[model samples]
Target: MTEFQAKEMEEQEEQIENEAEDNKEAEDSAPAEEQTGQSEVNEETLRNKEEEIKKLQEEQDELKNRLLRVQADYENYKRRTNEEKIKERKFRAQSLVEEILPVLDNFKRALDVQIESEEAKSLKQGMDMVYRQLTDAMEKEGVKEIEAVGKPFDPHLHQAVMQVENDEYEPNTVVEVLQAGYSLNDRVVRPAMVKVNS
Candidate 1:
């Protein structure tokens, strides 16, 4: 071959070798860029999952709080209903006891009259037995007599029928009980008629 043609062939071979090296560098850098992109995608997926977990936890807490509130309200309602029922029962018993007070007063008058007579001894005994039965029934129903005689007079339990001047006891004291007062379960059913010492 000629000298000029041989030199031209050598220069062409050098240019081809430089182009092959550049292509290999580009191929290696492409894999690095793809790895960086994959890492970013994984980070984004983790962040989304964390946010979802946080929201679920908040919702669970709210539901628990609501459940506790409902339970407390139910307990309060039960307590109130039980109290109302007890009050209703007490009121009913008090009303029934008040209705029988007049009969008890009549029995007291009859017993007083019978105890004053000697000829009516047998009749007095029968009347006394009846009085005992009535009083026993009243006691079973939580009825009690208020102490009036010789006690300090109270307008709430005693009605002053008359006032008298007396040196035997303190002034404003109850000296005589004309009609006995009664209470049912600590509530006054009837006020006593009494004489107060002034």
Candidate 2:
């Protein structure tokens, strides 16, 4: 071969090698950039998912707390209703007893009247028997008369209609019971009308 022709061939070969190396480097760097971009997208997606999970958990906890509060309120209402029912059952006979009190007082007044004849005496005996039966029934139903005469005056059991300056009784003492008081189950149905020593 001629010298000039050889030199031209060598230059062509060198240019071809340079082009190949540039293509190889561009291919390698393209994959690295693509990987970096993919990783950034993945990180963004993960952060979004975490935030969504946190919000959902918070909402679930709030709903659970509301459910617990409702259950507690329902339980309290049930307990209160049960207590009211028990109290109603305990005081069931209060109204009937109150209605019978006036009748009992009338019977007591009739028994206190003096009798002069045999027929009147017989009627008095009959009334006395009826009164005794009524009192026995009341006693069975937890009714009791409050002992106010000579007892220490208590506002809960006694209603003082008059105060007396009596030397025979101590201060704040119940000297006499004008009208009888009654109780049922240790609860005052009616307070005794009384005279108190001041």
Candidate 3:
């Protein structure tokens, strides 16, 4: 072969090698670009996940607040119910005490009457003792007698049976009490039957 032809063949081989090297470099650069794109997608997914977590936390907080409010409402309802029960008990006690007052007054009237014999006096004393015991029991339960004799005839406390004209006494005055009145806890159970002076 001629030297000129050999030199031309060497130059052609070198050019082919350079072209292969450039192709390899281009393949490596394409993989790096693909990796960068994948990283960007992963970052976007992570940001979306963080935002979802924040929304869930907010929902949890709202539910906790609602639960607290419900608990407070239940507590108030319990307190109110207890207070109502106590009031009902007190009212029932007052009514029961009022019902027993008339029986006690009858005993007092019976004791005030005079006895003719010793046996009768002994029986009367026993009855008086029983009356005292009953009155003591009533007092312990907050029962009391209303004032009626020789006082002004108040419509709230007394029921006037007969009116009498008297210059010695003031008009609308209670001259005598025919039936005693009773009270339970400052509330009148029965008004006194009285004779009023006009």
Give lDDT per model, in order: 0.80, 0.85, 0.77
TM-score of model 1 (CA atoms): 0.62
Please give the TM-score that candidate 3 achieves against the real structure. 0.56
Q: Write the residue-wise lDDT of candidate 1 on 85-157 in tens digits.
A: 9877665668777888888888877667524557688888888898888888878878899989889999999
Each model's RMSD to truth, in Å? 29.5, 28.7, 29.6
Candidate 2: tens digits of C-alpha lDDT, residues 1-198:
458857975885686578569658856765675676664767766776587579667766965786697689679979999999988776677899899998988889879987799999998998899899998998888898899988999999999999999999999999998889999878999999999999
Q: What's model 2's lDDT at 154? A: 97
Residue 106, candidate 2: alpha-carbon lDDT? 84
Q: Candidate 2, after superposition: displacement of residue 177 in Å?
A: 1.4
Question: Which wins on TM-score, candidate 2 or candidate 3?
Answer: 2
Model 3 Cα lDDT, one tens digit per residue, 1-198: 458757965875686577568657856775675676664767666776577578657756865785687688679879998999977765556767766767776777778887799999999988888888887787776677789777898898999999988777788888888888877767777888898998
Sliding window of 10 residues with minimal summed lDDT for model 2 = 30-39
Compared with the true structure, the alpha-carbon lDDT of candidate 3 equals: 0.77
- Total clashes, candidate 1? 0
Backbone Cα, N, C clashes tallied per candidate: 0, 0, 0
Give the Cα error of residue 15 in candidate 2, in Å.
78
Worst 10 residues of 3 by lDDT: 30-39
Which scores higher on lDDT, 1 or 3? 1
| Residue 19 Cα positional deviation in candidate 2, in Å, after optimal superposition | 66
